[model samples]
Target: MSKYFAVLLLLIFSTQIQALEKVTLQLKWTHQFQFAGYYMAKEKGFYQEEGLDVIIVPADPNNPNVDFRVLYGQAQFGVFHSGLLKQRLEGKPFVALAALLQSSPYCWMVKAQSGIYVPRDFQGKRISLLGHTENGELLMMLQRAGVNTDSMLLYSGKKPFDDFIAGKFDAMQVYSTNEPYQAQQLGVATREICPKQFGLNVYADVLFTTEAMLRDRPQQVMRFRRASLKGWRYAMLHLEESLAVTKANYATHKSLAQLAYEAEKLKDFIRVSGIPIGKMSAAKWLWIAQLYHLDVSQFHEHKADFIYSEVKQDPASLSWVLIIAAVLTLVCIPMYIQLIFSRKNKSHLR
Candidate 1:
């Protein structure tokens, strides 16, 4: 009787272990309240309930990009922004399982005391951005307001708000949830201008995988999405607990108070559109496509047309700029040649 009972326990344990499906999810950035829902999901055993052994991977700047990790099978899924959707339209093999935020938290932040009240005020001003991520939205806002694109200057330096805080620039682009809150905490009065003001609001924070994954492992994809969305709903209702989980697992530079502030801001962004959390719409994708001036008709059949939008570069006058650059390079050739020769001669003499 004792031997039979021991065998039953071992069998039960092995069955439980075998039931859990192992998978990895790559976050778009470091661990913080930004990923509170995922943490809460794990903490609550939502993934386990779905028979998934979900591994949450934080993004490391020193490592390959999150998209590459997912593509190379290091991770089965990843969290990215609307930019991924745009890339998909432009020929990436990615497919989004969820739009984490109904509308983007992306917007332009400007010091209100600097006498710039609106998008029109951005003319001839230095606006710090996160690479070209939000440039399309900015240009669209400026164009709609008749602001001259040439007069505007964009600075894409890392941790961009440092200069802006010191009053070194006219305005800076930031997520509605993050930098604006930082500015407020530091007592810098600011205003935000979003794409929605000009009818160009796009979705943000997508959980995605490759098209091949959807083709080959559709059930797994569905299970992951359902589990993640469920986790988000639970996190939304239990903000403090979810945040505590985030703080415990992923050390953040932010104070609990600051994270709380972000939590509130995130809640607003997630539910602002009155859509269910993790929902996407065809109209929103269509709007972003129009912002980039892509062919909307071609959007009909591509998964992109149904799933996302085509984001392209701005149509500013590149020809004249290229011509001037070529002329300048031609004139600088002799100087460059002399400098190179001088450096080489100096090295040899030494």
Candidate 2:
């Protein structure tokens, strides 16, 4: 009897241990303070506490295609640019889980004394950007300012800012956190031209997952977001602790000073004055789609409950009066008949 009881207990323990659902997350770029929230969540046992065994994977620096990892079965979730909407517009089944960076940190950079102070100055200049993000917004800024790109020379490649500092180009696209710090270290004075200054709103660093994941495992999805946001809040409040956790576990080439600088600089990028973290408005998504000129006619989506969350939506009071179509047609028919009789009277008089 004792031996049978021991064997049954062992089988139950093994089954409970195996019950934890495993998922992998792919990061957009190489590991750094940029991904500190995820690192904090992992190190602080938040994922484990949620009954998740998350495997965090960093992209190869040479190949930083993050969305495809989530789109395929290679990974269930990823942090990527809001430009993922372009793929979503194409009918791909990717659902945005959260907005990591409320504001985009991308801008055009040049030497401080390069005499290029405004978006208009980018006309007839050579420019290169690292990623596909914000490229459309940049062009729209120039176009709105009456700056022509016909004389513009563009290059799509990696690390163009180094070439920018070498005087191989007039201006290069840079993230406010990374390149400006590098230029400062190299004694290159760079003046960053921000898109927000030109009336462009961009969303960056979006967290997304597959439709299958969200649809099948909604409870786990909510758990992941809750824990991840908790991790982000802790990281922002405890910068040094988060950085220490990240650096100790993750491999990166950046020095301690560089990582620390990124941690401090990224706070502004992620935090808004009054908005909650991970909050996204449908207006923002629609504005981005408009900026990119994406045709979303097929989406047939609405603004209500646009973002996925566990919070119950408060019922909206009837703000709009429903106008009956039959009543509208009845009101217009008299005008239509009068116009036809008036035209007939004019014809008779002629």
TM-score of 2: 0.80
Predicted candidate 2 versus true structure: per-residue lDDT over 147-223, tens digit per residue: 88766887765557667787888877777778889998998887888777777867777888877887777777777
CA shift of 181, model 2, Å: 1.6
* Model 2 C-alpha lDDT versus the unseen true structure: 0.75
Scored by lDDT, model 1 comes in at 0.74
Q: How much does candidate 1 score in TM-score?
A: 0.79
Candidates' C-alpha lDDT: 0.74, 0.75
Model 1: CA > 4 A from native: 1-10, 61-65, 156-159, 304-350
Q: Number of clashes in every candidate structure? A: 0, 0
Superposed model 2: Cα runs more than 4 Å off: 1-17, 129-134, 155-159, 299-306, 311-350
Best by lDDT: 2
